[model samples]
Target: MGSLLSVFSGLFGSKERRILILGLDGAGKTTILYRLQVSEVVTTIP
Candidate 1:
């Protein structure tokens, strides 16, 4: 229905945001991404 379409649009109408993460090798970039994907707390050292 039109109302259902409007509600779905309202829920999903937000603009997309892009993020760029840059770091050198062994800088825990992958570790940080993994933690973010899993919603975990990560303790990392350089």
Candidate 2:
């Protein structure tokens, strides 16, 4: 399935774009992902 960001981007423009999230462990990658999917902040464990 496409990511939430991709879905939104498709609605705004024609050219497809991609994203890369780079961070060390426990840098809140999963937390950010959940926020993008749900549009809210959620508790996450590292």
Candidate 3:
């Protein structure tokens, strides 16, 4: 029981990890990821 509790606590205590975006070319994946990381507005044209 103590080990299970420790595992759960460890899992929940860590910070969120970096996001992984997978897509084909011209899919705006890079644009979106950058925008989120920088916390700023990003502009792009289709």
The CA lDDT of each predicted structure is 0.82, 0.84, 0.81
Task: Please tell me which predicted candidate would have the highest TM-score against the true structure.
Answer: 2
* Candidate 3 residue-pair clash tally: 0
Model 2: lDDT of residue 40: 92
- Candidates in order, TM-scores: namely 0.47, 0.53, 0.44
Put down candidate 3 lDDT per residue, 1-46, tens digits, no spaces.
9999999998988777776679998988868876877977587665
**Best-first order by TM-score:** 2, 1, 3
Better of 2 and 3 by lDDT: 2
TM-score computed on alpha carbons, candidate 3: 0.44
lDDT leaderboard ranking: 2, 1, 3
Which candidate's lDDT is highest?
A: 2
Residue 14 in candidate 1, Cα distance off native in Å: 4.6
Query: How well is each residue in 1-46 modelled by candidate 2, as lDDT tens digits?
Result: 5698888877897776687999999888888888988999899765
Residue 30 local lDDT, model 1: 74
- Model 1 lDDT per residue over 1-46, tens place: 9999999998789878567999998878878787878888676665
- Number of colliding residue pairs in each model: 0, 0, 0
Better of 1 and 2 by lDDT: 2
Q: Note the residue pairs that clash in candidate 2.
A: none
Instruction: Report the lDDT of model 2 for residue 9.
Output: 78
Residue 2's lDDT in candidate 1: 100
